[model samples]
Target: MKYKAERDCKTYLDTGRLFAPSSKSCHVGLNQVGSLPLEVRSWTCSNCKIKHDRNVNSAIIIGDEGLGLLALGTSTYCP
Candidate 1:
């Protein structure tokens, strides 16, 4: 069974990058890898210079992916 975290990580990897929650143009690639093990829930984007919550960031990505699928006429559901 695939967990949401696995899907979220896959989404990030396939996109080849991550963006700041506050500044969509700001890239934060693999910079937070070390922070995850420490159970870091939030961080400041170097480019955006704004803090972002981990849960919020993941929700945004997942929401966007769902919207993309909806626009493509794909069902956003699992059995």
Candidate 2:
């Protein structure tokens, strides 16, 4: 997106951190990789106690962070 959008897009260290079932409720965090699939079918937040569609939630996170990076002029990718 950084290259194609011609705008600053960042790969947040926390991008992949969203998928850990353990951190399902914790939301954002530092970089960490887990033994999870590339696309989870569904999930529920432990803390919030609410169900969520995996893809939708991920898009929200990625989009929010990407916009943040654009504001900072620090484009990046999901790694």
Candidate 3:
């Protein structure tokens, strides 16, 4: 038997831009430089100056990317 495993979007640009937890109000994505360490659970966006939860932000990014891929007709399964 053969099996295939699905994966979540895990690629973060080395520029760290992907790590940016965008500000909901301004919709700005900024590199989370020096942030998101193991102990850090949240951060404030420099653009909009809004605080964001790290986990929640990460989830949002992953979801968005997954949706984007779907919209592109790249994947039929929802990641």
Candidate 4:
């Protein structure tokens, strides 16, 4: 017998845009940071054991609280 496990995954564009049918040019948390190296796709937080995508982690940092001061254009200021 053959068996396979299915996992849910979503792909984002190189520009950090979500691959949703209705997605716009909004800057998601993943886009602000950049792409993840092929080898370091996932990492565990030093303090927390939380597993995070390298790309997504960086984006979160870029969009962290108090980051509004560094806003560049509409991409950063978009509500």
Best by TM-score: 3
Clashing pairs in 4: none
TM-score of each: 0.48, 0.47, 0.55, 0.35
**Candidate 4 local Cα displacement, residue 32, angstroms:** 19
**In model 2, what lDDT does residue 17 have?**
52
lDDT of 3 by residue, 18-62 (tens): 545442212246445454566867677776677777667766665
Worst 10 residues of 3 by lDDT: 1-10
RMSD of each: 8.8, 7.7, 7.7, 14.5
Candidate 3, clashing residue pairs? none
Ranked by TM-score from best down, the candidates are 3, 1, 2, 4
How does residue 55 of candidate 2 score in lDDT? 61
Please give, for residues 1-79, the per-residue lDDT of candidate 1 as tens digits.
2366456543212322353332222223423333343276776766557676776766666566556666776543433
Instruction: Tell me which of candidates 2 and 4 scores higher on lDDT.
Output: 2
Give the clash count for model 4.
0
Tell me model 2's lDDT, rounded to 2 decimals: 0.51
Native RMSD of candidate 2 (Å): 7.7
Enumerate clash totals for all models, in the order shown: 0, 3, 0, 0
